[model samples]
Target: APDAPGATLTALPSLDLSRPAWRAGFDETPATVLADGAAAAGAIRRAEIATCIALGAECVGVAGHALELTVDHARTRHQFGRPIGAFQALAHTLADLTVTVEVARSAAAYVTRCGGDERSAHTLAVKASEAAVTVTTEAIQLHGGIGFTWEYPAHVLLRRAHAAAVLAGTPDQHRRALFALVDER
Candidate 1:
């Protein structure tokens, strides 16, 4: 109902271009007993896994859009009497990124379809987030100094990807947990 006990919601400002975020600050706040504490940890884990899976999808969408923007720019923005997309180097890079995005997309979809398999959820999150960051960064670079500008969407995509990466747990944290899980098996 009300803000959870001592949890004060704060609107966080950022250079994320458009989407704003919030933080819940919990101090010596009052506690309202919701349910049994024993299962809380398990519930929290499931929630985190679900959140990561959703964020993975979001990452795919952002990366895919950024890739589209880069493709369009490469086709229209000419250099040295030809489109940059015509260059072998840039073409190869684009092709690689395209494959990466597609793979990430499929991974995200697979994890979602599996109902967020705990073993693979974090991995997919890491993959999708990294893919988004990679594509958006390249999108900006391909834009020639305009990528990070306030007028560019690449910066927004990058910001969103970073935010998503950190929301459920950073890639390093996810990888660490994954490694630990592997070790346990």
Candidate 2:
């Protein structure tokens, strides 16, 4: 097959880091010498947005589960002859976490329904990533010392939230993207 006019295919070695990240570089060679690749840049962008959406959804799910675990722990873990969850501070914190998780879920679902809307996808990714990190961190706090230990799953969820937040695009980056889109309009 003939190479596409404005595209080239290069085989570059890559390294995968934590949270599904890759590093690759294209050579500075002239385009004439490289094999042309299919798919326009727009198509690639759309695919990347789709990937971000899926990753955002995963983060939301993780946050949701972590919230559930924290809630259950609060309800069952007794303190002062009563469940700690009965305390106002703990109850309010749990309520906030629940709201964040729900908002993140709504954002993810909106992006999923919107198909490949780049702005919406970016916003969703940012919101979901932030929610995951916040919810997971709060979960660890609510779990007391047990959350920090390896035996508990709070640490695992925190690590995943951190990783997911960095992947696709960081919250700051997504925010900037949203700002740019708003500026364009």
Candidate 3:
């Protein structure tokens, strides 16, 4: 990937996230043939599966961390002579976010330990992307003005989740492919 023939490695415009454009142009450009036979296909399949699993795990981590930060902030930052977390609405939202992060974590861990099939990757992708993006966005809102600033981690997590979601195709694309695979069964 670092050096491949017929691949321009054109850098896309700056992303909102901090990640470098490590993957691009393999589809559009007729890159040099890395492999061709059935064995090669199998290797590629395995690689894609690994990538998807890793991405899902990464999203889980991101969302979990963001949620932790938000919860800490809520507990410490007070409103109307009480901690923000004491408010019923915020406490409920945090509870939901906690569930979301935990569910994604469990799914990622299950797929990691069970050696799940190709279709499992898509399911994990949809869940992880949704959870990570949702938690980080909520973190940003809950953190008030501080969340949007570079000083806080919420914005960074949001950007990371957004960027990672597009890597193995967006969540919606994966959902469609997952349904197709299921229907094929």
Candidate 4:
């Protein structure tokens, strides 16, 4: 072990149970006798980005499912002898949510098709993360009182959105990176 190059791996302790999240931090302590530490570091960074992209897509999928549940509720829940979804206001809001989910899905699909481009992948991550939060929030609002209760699945989707938004990178951080990318062009 002393003569050959090696990398150390450590499993960090859990942070807290109040919030559902996973985090790991690495310190790039100098590796003695290592010829190319930079290359290893770069590979690790790429892996992190790839993970972020995958999680972002997952968040989008979660939001899409939440949307479907809300729409179903709206269509079936009747008020004044008519389905609530028949109302123009609720219908329009659901339509807009559908558009957001579709756009986020497209961005996610783009990232899958072009996995080699880190910039586009990060862009998709940003879009999907934001879309998840926004769409989930809207879904909760559409679900009315029941959505606020812990017994309902809408709150679960909202909690997941909040957790995903902060994972890998915040929406603001990703937006800054996207702006920088645009500036570079």
Candidate 5:
């Protein structure tokens, strides 16, 4: 029964990208419903993956778009007496963020191609979740303090990544799914 303590859920509750109400719902559903839930969950999972792929693309895009602007900003934005980007600290940070975003993008693309295998999907999901977190966090860091401010769009990207990580499953959730896939084998 859907009300059972460990039922596997099947139905993908209507979700609003503007909101995150399903995380709690999925957590509570009984595992018994997995028979039905798996199909629905798979569909939902696929959709979520598609969303993440698109988002990951955006992350890559922003990094590409911002590179020039960041270069100019670093060149012009004065610190104590010089441009902040000229400092090794800022340069390294930007470099690291760029690397993270690229790696995340590659991982997402690989995962998108890993179709149908539950185990693979589970692994891919976890990887994508990590990618989402890493890229978004780096994006925020590269942006500096303004990244944290609501007025900046960096927060919006972070929020979307966060939501994507939670959807279908969290990092731990996907890991468990991977284990399940192995066990099933």
Candidate 6:
């Protein structure tokens, strides 16, 4: 990625937040700002699809984390002289989480691989949006009461998914894009 004019010459290989002075100042952004901004907007839409796929992957990871924690809690957290997770409710939850993770992973991967065309962009948006909601909800559910609590990490992931689901474009926006793309054909 070459610097676009006002993009500063840097010794580092990445954007540096440590030195705010070198960052794009208001004055430096006059010429390429609009063009770069437009490019960025378009890129965000595309990359958001990829990001949604990545977030879904994170959901799967969270599922595994939840399972491991569930196992640990089952062994340590006692209820009626037994682990609470030994209950059928807990077992079913673990199973459901596993299934949810698998489904999200498959859906995200499918959309990423298949949705490269203008037509598929809409589908990608749809899947990413859906994945954001589905994955966050399931992740929260699998974590039980703690999942809802502010102290828990699941909420962070859930929030991220929620935000990702809506960014770049909403589901309706993507649907409209699909229609527009098709209409152009």
Predicted structure with the largest TM-score when compared to the true one: 1
Model 2 C-alpha RMSD to native = 5.9
Model 2 Cα lDDT, one tens digit per residue, 1-185: 12444335544432212344333434453354232345566667878798789889889988998999999999999999999999999999999999999999989878867875988889888989999999999989999999998557887888888877776889999899889999999
TM agreement with the true structure for every prediction: 0.88, 0.80, 0.86, 0.80, 0.58, 0.53
Question: What is the number of residue pairs that collide in model 2?
Answer: 0
Candidate 4 lDDT over residue span 102-162, tens digit each: 9888888888788647777777778888888888889889889999987578888887787
User: In model 5, which runs have C-alpha deviations exceeding 4 angstroms?
Assistant: 1-76
Cα deviation of 181, candidate 3, in Å: 2.1
Instruction: Tell me which of candidates 4 and 5 scores higher on TM-score.
Output: 4
- What would the per-residue lDDT of candidate 5 be over residues 109-145, giving only the tens digit for each residue? 6665765345545555566556656655665666678
- Cα misplacement distance, residue 57 of candidate 6 (Å): 5.0
C-alpha lDDT of candidate 6 relative to the true structure: 0.57
Model 3 CA deviation exceeding 4 Å by range: 1-7, 22-34
Q: After superposition, how far is residue 11 of candidate 5 from its true place, in Å?
A: 19
Candidate 2 backbone collisions, by pair: none
Clashing pairs in 6: none
Give the lDDT ranking, best first.
3, 1, 2, 4, 5, 6
lDDT of 1: 0.83
Candidate 2, after superposition: displacement of residue 135 in Å? Answer: 0.4
Q: All candidates' lDDT scores?
A: 0.83, 0.83, 0.85, 0.79, 0.60, 0.57
Off by over 4 Å in 2: 1-39
Task: Output the number of the lDDT-best candidate.
Answer: 3
Segments of candidate 4 deviating more than 4 angstroms: 1-19, 22-36
Backbone clashes (count) for model 6:
0
Model 1: per-residue lDDT, tens digit, 1-185?
23666678888876464667778777977766665676888788888888888888888899999999899989999999999999999999899999989989888878867777886787888888889888888888888888868666877788887777677888888888889889998
